[model samples]
Target: MTWILVLVAIGLLSAVLLLRTRRTRQKNEPPLDKGIFPWLGHALEFGKDAAKFLTKMKDKHGDIFTVCVAGNYVTVLLDSNCYDAVLTDTKSFDLTRYSQLLMDRIFNLHLPNHDPVSERKRVNQYFNSSNLSRLCSTMRNNLQFLIASADTQNPTEWKKDTLFDFCYSLLFKAGYQTMFSTENDNTAKFTDVYEEFRRFDKILPKLARRAAARDELKFASSARKRLWELLSPNCFLTGSVTQSWMQTYLQHLKEQGLDTETQRRAMLLQLWVTQGNAGPAAFWLLGFLLTHPEALKAVKAELCSLQHLPLDKTEDTPVLNSVLKETLRLRAAALITRDVMQDKTIKLSNGQEFVLRKGDRLCIFPFLSPQMDPQIHHEPEKFKFDRFLNSDETMFCKEGLQMKYGTMPWGAGSNLCPGRDFAVCALKQVVHMILTQFDLELCDCNASMPPVDANRYGFGMLQPDGDLKVRYKLKKHN
Candidate 1:
């Protein structure tokens, strides 16, 4: 009887383990696949290359399916047409908790009145598309000054460095100065900030996932602390020309009774959000243009004709816009993630329905379908500078399933980036200034394009795994 009882206990324990480790699909749910691993299902494959893994999964199971990843079952939506069902449904979906979770995980940040919705609204008000005159004016001045200051040693002499390093470093400095005012264009000070930022950014993905090893965690923690010190309230307040938005944000934080430390952490988060993507984007845009000679010629021609600060984006430049559109489509890969607030059935625009369970995650990898799918974009992997232009160059190409927005860089609804217009203006500013004000070219024209760092598939701007050597010199102003 004792032996039988022991056997029964073991059997019951095993049953409980199986129940905890596995999942069962209820009616109307998406196709579920819990991989062979007990708790870490398909995490290895997914982490290795999310795009490739998701593509394989899409082939195996239709456009939508739930796969267990790192113990969480995430229902991924691949159909571009169906993204609205997820983005607009505030009652059933929530991203604020997830965003806050990342903040604590990555930045060690916790706010008193942590309301992202209200915060985003205030941010949008500052970054309003209708009136970006102040920010745009400052950004242009900073860009020109920084460009001229970059190589005071030799105006005509060609300076050489890895292109990605040059682009990101310069743009980051300019963007930093534009957002957080400084008494002087202290190149050394801002460059140090960008260096520390780069260090923190490299390990950010692992940090967010709670998967950083000993060395990575140590580096991230140290780098973040240093960043906090650099952008501390004292340093930030001393700046004479702090943007209005910064002033408003600081006042709001103080109203919430946040301490100096909390406010500093908040500033760091803002830095990451505002100054992060533009540089990498500039890198990709310039890299593509340099490699493609005809594209280089066309964009330069367009810049030559511009008579104003903000070129009538509605009518003036088509070639430059197309090139930018192509670059973003190829390089931007953001994983739109949301928490399933309740058990809700999501009906796709195509009329397919799938039930998402409460406590599960919903993921939309637009980079896979709408952005890079060959069916939607012809020769999707190849860079076609004119891919988005009509034959007469009157309208951007919006054929196939792209009845709405062709690419999703800013995402949708409340999660839609308020800084969208400003970011694009910044990119165009960088490209226009670089091409028209400086002479740049690849060191080795025949060398292959650098491979993208696969680890950053879900991150916003996809950085190249390897760097390309490039040379540039200041062009004589007319």
Candidate 2:
């Protein structure tokens, strides 16, 4: 009798779900794929390989289509034609709200829900033209200290290290000290907090699930607590002469009447944001150079030519800048997402229109649409070091067209990343320093490009599935 009742309950649930799905399809929505499972939807398939899945769908259903993933329907715009719609339609689409949702789920904390525009403006001020020169000097000093310290035991021998780990450690320390003060006495304690934060970051996909179990929640909670403890006012505020960017941020939080715990959580998020994309990006940029000998030779020659110029003026090295741009294009799996605040009609450049209802999500996968579009980038799969350089020593473009939204590694419009300028400068400095100060080579010259972690698709930069080993020895002059 119990078995029969269980079967009846399952049957009723399936019937209701079928009816709801039919109703959703009846509306004038983009083509929806619910996949095989009911509520699970296309989450598994989409998670496995986002670019390929989206490409197959785009080929079948034009540039616009919807896919149900974990009970939410997301409409993807997959061509340059629809770029303006995502960038300009800020009134109907809200990126901040979407960002907040992800942050809340992953961190398991409720941040003060407020307009981020003012915050963005304030942060941008810190990275403005006047302040960048000083910041760059600080970063250079930090990088030099890190590299020098690593060779204390045996300076003459080549050190074998994983590029990802080395970059992450160096960047995390440098970025932390640059934004925050370096006066803290508890370096060991802060290092502990950083490790915990990394562990928490790795399990974000599991934690984002609505049905996340207690064990997962417990781990995330513990990590957050440790981070909060380390970033407490007593620890973070002490031992700094000049005012750090974090000090100003803390002051703002205090003025907003947020509690100490909230402020710490906010700081943790900031720490993650500042160093997150940079480490992986630096790794890929250097990795690409190591694998391609011709590109390496050209970039090295460019660096040699610019040796007479001031190291602070990274803009002078246009070839290195082009390589960085290409790396961002190839490695960044940026998923620009917006929540539909109200019902709206989205008209594309190709004369097709779609009605997006309230609560729906609109996303653009730049990895597929623009970055790998052969129409815009010839031989998009291959790494061309000078792809973004022109004969006139200016930025390259597609078919003599400007293409404003063509290469959006940092993003577009009001939603653009505030740390973009700082990130670019930091990457250039790291690469320039590495090339000039060290003699480096891949342990395995035949090692292919590292596979991108598909789960990190929507989170700005894509990380490698695993670390790659490289051998290095300090140059005599450095």
Find the candidate with the highest lDDT and give its number.
1
TM-score of each: 0.92, 0.89
> lDDT score, residue 36, model 1?
91
Question: Tens digit of lDDT per residue, candidate 1, span 1-478?
Answer: 9999999999997786577566888898999988998767888888878999999999899788999887788999887767876788877889778888889998999875788778888888887755576788778888988888777897899889898888898789888888875564376779789999999999988887787999999999899999998887666555443455555678788899999999999988988888888888988999999889999999888888764447326356778888988899999999988999999987765677888999999999878877877666678899999987654323223332333446777776557888888788888888888887778888998866789998888889999999889998887766
Candidate 1 structure, TM-score to reference: 0.92
Q: How far is candidate 2 from the true structure (C-alpha RMSD, Å)?
A: 3.4
TM-score, candidate 2, is 0.89
The local distance difference test score of each candidate is 0.82, 0.76
Candidate 2 residues 1-478, lDDT tens each? Answer: 9999999999998887775455365366778776778776777777767787888888888778888877678888875656766667778888788778877887645666556677788888888887877887787787777778778887878999999888777777777778775475445764676588677777666665444568877887888788777777656665556677888788888888988878888888787777777788988999899989988998888887555335456557878878888899898887778888888877765556778877878888878767887767788888998887753313334455444454778776666788787788788878877887789998998987788887777677888898789999988863
Root mean square deviation (Cα) for candidate 1: 3.8
Q: List the candidate 2 regions with Cα displacement exceeding 4 Å.
A: 1-19, 24-28, 185-190, 209-218, 239-241, 305-315, 391-402
